[model samples]
Target: MHKIKRDDLVKVIAGKDRNKQGKVLNIDAKNNKVTVEGVNMITKHVKPSAGNQQGGIVQKEAAFDISNVMLVVNGTATRVGFEVKDGKKVRVAKATGKVID
Candidate 1:
């Protein structure tokens, strides 16, 4: 299972945005990357198109490697670990004693 999912709060553990917390916007499982809202912003210049009438420099979030982020759980960012409880799979937040369903 993917540790990061849409709407999941996460903290950037590495890169220029380290320590920044944001919600997960998208995930590219095949590439092992995720786009966190307001993190890793990049500028892209686009040519004017019929659909985008005023295509120009646009600032947007870029995907970062999933390994560089830690999921925020119970008010703290922590490493996620999995275990079986009552024959059901579960993930735990190492920083706090909480189960991530």
Candidate 2:
């Protein structure tokens, strides 16, 4: 399993949006990138298309290097750890040593 999953609360630890927290929207495991809501906003100019009647400059979230984000646990950013519990691997918060369910 990946350390960061969809809907997980994460905080950008690097780049222009450093320290900004947002929910994880998508994960690109092959590229090691993740898209977070309200982070890495980029404007794109689009021509009018059949699907989109009014296509102009639109703002959207862009994927960032997963290494640049840290998972948020208990309202704080923490490193992820793994341990076996009940014969199954489970995620743990390094900072608090608590199981992340």
Give the number of the best model, judged by lDDT: 2
Report the alpha-carbon TM-score of model 2 versus the true structure.
0.97
Residue range 1-101, candidate 2, lDDT tens digits: 98999999999999999999999999999999999999999999999999998999999999989999999999999999999999999999999999998
Candidate 1 structure quality by residue, lDDT tens digits, 19-101: 99999999999999999999999999989999899999999999989999999987688888888899987888877758898
Residue pairs with backbone atoms closer than 3 Å in model 2 (clashes)? none
Query: How many clashes in each structure?
Result: 0, 0
lDDT of 2: 0.96
Error of 1 at 47 (Å): 1.5
- Scored against the true structure, residue 39 in model 1 reaches a CA lDDT of 100
Per-model RMSD to reference: 1.4, 0.6
Specify the poorest-scoring 10-residue window by lDDT in model 2.
44-53
